[model samples]
Every structure is written in structure tokens, then in C-alpha cells.
Target chain A: MLHMLEKTIADNPLITAFAFVGVVIWVSNQIGRHLTGGRVAGSAIAVLGGLALAYWGGAVTGKAKGLADIATFSGLALMGGAMMRDFTIVATASEVHVDEAKKAGWLGVIALLLGTVLPFIIGVLVAWSFGYTDPIALTTIGAGAVTYIVGPVTGAAIGASSDVMALSIATGVVKAIMVMVFTPVFARFMGLSTPQSAMVFGGLAGTVSGVSAGLAATDRKLVPYGALVATFHTGLGCLLGPSVLYLAVKAITW
Target chain B: MVIFGTALLAACYLAGIWVGEAIAVLIGVKANVGGVGIAMIFLIAAQHFLKTKGLFPADTEKGVTFWAMMYIPVVVAMAATQNVVVAIKGGPIALLSAVGSFLLCFGVVALINRSMQRHASPEEADASAALASAPDALKSR
Candidate 1:
């Protein structure tokens, strides 16, 4: 019986992966409700918990893929791969209504610009303070502060080394998670209720997944608006990062 | 369950990625630029088109919701894939930059909201506007 179950689990890795995530989510939700008293979202806790587990996995296995590197959870690598990531991103748009999203007008454009530029400046400043004087590294990491996608795109465009590009991606990923966790926590203080504010916030937030997740937590209606505007960040960041932003950073440093 | 919309989603995803790749190539980057966002746009357009044609089935929403509710799990899975230990070991700069940028940006966003409130966009003052007081907003789909 045990051998049969083991073979079944081994053969159906995706199902096993779903089961594992299911249990993690169930427990996390209970903890969120009972322990946190619904102050912190269960989903947020699950993501953080997953990160912690991944950190532990890396510490123990000395591998970079996190929990996906483990043999039993090997299915996680596939489940969390680019295909699934992009698919899930695409799928969530199912609920979005176009007419409603059209509410964000030119104000959204300004928000998107400020959202992209502000973070890039902060990123460049931090890199500068950290003693990174190279134009390519500074631009790449600053682009990363915009979004994980922007980071690599800028890095590749400006000839940043692979290590620097990786760092930029890491920076972007951390920023995404932070946005996701903090969006709901601070939603009330920020007047994140209306479609207009959501659009503006999405512009300033500057990440599709992070903003989508955050807005979804705050208000389902706001997700499409925030995500609609937030989607522009990458293209704007990618355009500005390698050219205008890089030049500004280089003018002062180089 | 009909489990519809997957085909539409896959088609949109592929189109978005192809266009994203083309954009990246045009700009001299080796990555798929805005593929996910583009895919989402395509999805939205396609759904709208389908609805106009009356080809959009009401039951299709079920399929979409099935995947949509799985969003948090997907996020968790994605988070689990990141090797946080190695990222931290890369240096403090990456972490510091992220935190500092977030702090400043959040402050700026708050300022934007405060200014908006000072002007008071009619519905915003409706006592239920607060996230906690708004029952419907809190009930996430």
C-alpha cells in the first residue's frame, strides 16, 4: 500500500504540488484568522512563509532554486516556472471589465511616469551610496527598483554583467513582495478605495503582479484599475532606464 | 465543468509573448518585455470582443474564476521559487535599495492621496470609503 502510494505521488507530481500548496494555504489562512485576527492577510502570510521556506531550502541545499530544488517538491519548479507565472497573470484578468478600467485618464499617465522615475532615482542613489559608480550597474539596478522585468531588460541593453543583472532582479523581486504585503496594511491611510486613487497608486507602485495582488486584497474592483496603469511601468521604465536615467546618473557620477 | 477560456488565455499569452519578444528585439534586449502585461491586454480585448459578438458564455466566468481564485497560491509558488538566502548574500545594497525605494515611494503615494482628499473627490468622503468600514471592498473575490 505504501509503495503504491509512493509511486502514485511520484508519477503525479503536479497533483502532489497542488496538495502541498493547498495544505500550506489552509494552515496559513487559519493562522491569519485565529492568530493574526485577520489583520495580516492569509495570502500575504503564505507568500512570506513560502519565502522563508525557500530561504531555508537554499540554506540547507546550497541551491538557488529554493524549495523547487528539493526532489519531492520538484514539481514546484514547473508550477512556479515562467509559463505558469505568465499564465496566472493572464488568467486573473478574467474578472476585469474594460469599461470600468477606462476611468483612469491622463492622470494615470502622470502617475505612471512619477511611479517609474521616483523609484529609479531612489535605486540609483542607493547604488551610488553603496559605491557602485558604474553606469551600467547603476542603471540596471535602478531599473530593477522599477520592476524585475525592467531590471534585466535594462541590464541587457546597457551591457551590465550577469552578476549585476541578477542583483537587479533580486532587488525588483523584493520590492514586488514588499508592495504586495504593505498595500493592504496601508490601504486605509492612502485613500486606496476609489478607481482614481487606485489608478494613481498603481502608477506609483509600478508592478503588475505586486499591484494586482495588493489591489485585489484591498478591493477586487480596484485590481483592474491599478493593474491597468501599473502595466505601463515596465515599458516606461525600460525606455527611461537605459537612456535618460542612465545619463542623469552618469552625469553626476562619471 | 466546461473549463472554458483556457484556450483563449493560451492564445492571448502566446500572442503577448511574441509581441513582447518583438519589442525586446527592436530595443536590443534579450528578454520578453511586458509579455505578461501584453497578454493581459490581449485577454481583455479578446473577452470584450467575444462579449460583443454574444459568443461569451456566462459559464466561462466560472472557468476564469477557478483560475483567478488560485491567484494567491500562484503567488506563493512564485515566492517559493526565489532563493532568498542567496539574494541576501549577494549584498546589502539590493535589500537596502528595495526598502529605501519602497519607503520613499509609499510616502509619495500617501502624499498624493492626502492631496486628493484635501480636494475631496465626492465619493471618497462617503463614510464607507475607509477600507475597514467598506464591507464590500473588504470581501475580496
Candidate 2:
């Protein structure tokens, strides 16, 4: 029976992938509820679980793409590919109402711009401190500070080394995890109880998952408002990271 | 009716991809011009237009919302499987830079928030104070 199940899963990669994700989500939710008393978002826990699984898979298979390296889990690569990423992003955007978004007003816009530029600057400085003196590496790492998505995008654009690009991504992920863990704890101190404030928080935080999970822990209703502006941060970071920011870093470094 | 909404989403996504590609070409860049961003803008605009025209059905909105909710879980999954293995192998610089940036960003945000609060009008401050005291108010949709 076990052999039959293994063969079935190996043959139906997509089905196995879905089932694997389902189990992960279930276990993560269980951990969230029981361990953290739902103070941590299930999504956050699930992500941690997924990361653990990825590491374990890599160790077991000694291949890139982590779990996708496993024969039966090859469907994971496709499932988590850009197509699905873009699709999910679009779906999330579809939920935004323009009239409602306008309520964030100019404060949110300032926050969004500041959020992107400030993070980029800090990222660049940090990269410089780390001895990445080349403009391309600096810009890519700096962009990664804006968001993991921006890091790879900028690195690919300017031809940063794969190692630098990976560092950039790591930087972004660490920032994201910090945002996820700290948002609720700081929500009160930050005055994030209002929709407008939530919008600004989203812009400043600039990680969709982090802001969403943070807001979910703080106030479920604020998730949409926060996520709305946070979504724009990615676009703004992408636009600026490879162009304006890159040029500025180049002018300095060169 | 739900199928119509799904079709609209697909249309918006395709238009977004086209626009993103066109912009990238115009800029003479090899990278994508953020198709997801363009597609989102298109989706939002289309949804607004449809609503304004009163052509959008309630059922369609429900369908769209359902799909949008589903996307969050997908993101959680993506977050979990990102390139930690490579990042870890990249050396201590990666971890240090990440930690440094995280701290700097956090401190800056806190400072900015404090300054903004200090500059708030007395009435706005009062309102925020009340809101803070009763977070249940924030939880209601």
C-alpha cells in the first residue's frame, strides 16, 4: 500500500505538490494556534515551515530549487513560478478599491517614497560596510533591502554576481521576518490603529507578507489597507532600484 | 457570472503583461517592467470602470474576492521556499547586511513615526489616542 502511494505521488507531481502544501499549511496553522496563540500569523508559521522543508530537501537531495529537486516534488518549481506569483499579485490587486485607496491620501504617498528610498540608502550603506564596493553589487544589495523582489530584479538588470544577488535576497528576507515579528508589538507605539496609519505602515514596511501578517495580528480589518500601499512599494522599488538608485550608487562608488 | 469576472481578470493580466513588456522595450532594458504591477493597475481600473457603469454584478465581486483571498496562501508558500540555502552559503556578509539593514530601517521608521505624531494636530492626536485605546474599533470593517 505504501509502495503504491509513493508510485502514485511520483507519477502525479501536481497532485502531490498540492497535497504537500495542504499538509504544511495544516501543520503551520496548528503551530500558530497552539504555540503562539495566534499572535503569529499562520502564513508566517507556514512560511517558516516551508523554509525548513526547503533546507531539509536541499540537504537530502543536494540540489538547487530545494524541494523541487526531489523527483516527486518537481511540480513545486512550476507551482511557485513567476506565473503563479504574478497571478496571485494580480488577484490581490483586484481587491483594492481606488476610492478607498485614495483615503490614504498624500501622507501615504510620502511614506511610500520614503520607505523605498530610505531602505535603499540603508541597504547600500550596509553593503558598503560589508565591503561590497562595486556599484552593481551595492545597488543590487541595496535594492534587496527594499524588497527581495527588487534585489533579484536589480541584480539581473545590472549583472551583479549570483553570490551578491543571493545576499541581497537574504537581506530582504531578514527584513521581512523582522517586520512580521515586530509589527504587532509596535503597532500601538506606531499609532497604527487607523486606516490611514495602516496605509503608512504598509508603505514603510514594504513587504506584503510581513505587513499583512503583522496587521493580521494587530487588527484583521487593517490588513487590506496596509497591504494596498505595501503592494505599491514593490513596484516603486523595482522602478527605482535599477535606475535612479543604481545611478546614484555608481556616481558615488565610481 | 463568476466566469465573466475570471475572464476580466485574465484580460487585465494579459494587458498588464503587454504594457509591462512594451515599457521594458521602450526603456531598452532586458528585465521585465513589472508585469504584475501593470496588471494590478489595469485590474483596479477595470473594476472601477465596471462598478461605475453598474455593469458589475455582486456575484462577480464575490468571485473576485474569493480568488484574491486564495492568493495570500500562495504567497505564504512562496515565502517559505525562497533561496535560503544559497543565501546562507554566501557568507557572513549576507547575514550581517541583512541584520544591519533591518535595524536601520526599524529605527528610521520609529523615528519618523514619532516625528509625525509630534507634528499631528491636537484634534488628530486626540482622535488617534481614542482609536488606540479602543483597538476593537480598528478591527471592525
Index of the highest-DockQ prediction = 1
The local lDDT score (0 to 100) that residue A225 gets in candidate 1 is 67
* Number of the top-ranking candidate, with TM-score as the measure: 2
Candidate 1 segments exceeding 4 Å error: A1-3, A124-199, A206-254, B1-4, B114-141
Candidate 1 structure quality by residue, lDDT tens digits, B1-141: 335677777788799778877876886654555665677778888998999898878787566656656766865676676667755655677798889888877888888877987888566555225422222211244
- lDDT (Cα) of model 1: 0.73
lDDT of 2 by residue, A1-254 (tens): 99998899888876777777888888888987898776665665665566666767677876666677878877676666556656665766765667655655687788888888887888888778867789888888888888776676667656676556656766776777778788888877777766667777888888777788788888977787777778778766765776667777877887
Residue pairs with colliding backbones in model 1 are none
Residue A239 accuracy (lDDT) in model 2: 59
- Candidate 2 has an lDDT of 0.71
Docking class of 1: acceptable
TM-score, every prediction: 0.74, 0.81
